[model samples]
Target: MAKLKDKRREKISVATEIDRLEERRSRCQDNLERAEFRSRKEKLTEKERQELEDEMAIMNERVQKLNKELDTLRGENRKNMLLSIALLAISAFFYYIFFYNEEDP
Candidate 1:
C-alpha cells in the first residue's frame, strides 16, 4: 500500500512536469509564430532574430530533457511492477504450500 502511494505520487509528479513542459513549449511556439508573422510583414532585427533562435533552442532542450525524464520514470515503474509481481507470486507460493492440502481417504 505504501509502495502504491509512492507510485501514485511519482506518477502525479511526472504528469505535472509533462504538463508544465508542454505548456512552456506551446508558449514558445506561439511566440515564434508571432515573430515569424511579424518578420513576413517587415523584418526582424538581428538581435531579435538571435533571441528567438535562442528561445527555440532552449525550448527544444527542455522538451528533450522532459522526454528523457519521462522515459526514465517509465522504466522505473516497469521495474517496480515486475518486482511487485514477483513478490506476490512468492507469497502465493508460500500460501499454497502452507495452506493447501489434499483429502486423504
Candidate 2:
C-alpha cells in the first residue's frame, strides 16, 4: 500500500534524475565538441580549454553517480518483487491449511 506507493515514487524520481543527468552529459559533450572545433579553426586560450575539460569532468562524474543510483533502484525493485512473491506463497499455504482441511473428511 503505502510502501508500494513510496517505491513507485522513488522509481520515478530515479528515472527522472537519470534522464536529467543524460541530458546534461549530452549538452556538455556538445559544448566540448564546439570548443574543439573552435580550437581547430583558430586556437583556444588555455583558460577556455581548461574550463571545457573541467565541465566535461564534472558532467561525467554526475552521470556516473546517476547510473549508480539507477542500478540501486533496480536492485530494490527486484528485492521488493521477490518479497511480495514469498509473502503471497506463504499466505496461500496458510489459506489452504485453514480452508482445505475443513472440506476434507
- The lDDT values for all models are 0.71, 0.71
Candidate 1 structure lDDT: 0.71
Q: Cα lDDT for residue 16, model 2?
A: 64
Tens digits of per-residue lDDT, candidate 1, 1-105, equal 999977876667544655665677577667667656665676779998788668767766765675676677667667877998999999999988877864557
TM-score (C-alpha, index-matched) for candidate 2: 0.55
Q: Which ranges of candidate 2 are over 4 A from the true structure?
A: 1-43, 103-105
Give the TM-scores of the predictions, in the order they appear: 0.58, 0.55
In candidate 1, list every pair of residues with a backbone clash. Answer: none
- Deviation (Å) of 29 in candidate 1: 7.6
Give the range where candidate 2 is weakest over 10 consecutive residues by summed lDDT: 13-22
lDDT of 2 by residue, 1-105 (tens): 999977876667544655665676577567657656665686668998788667767756765675676577667767877998999999999999998868655
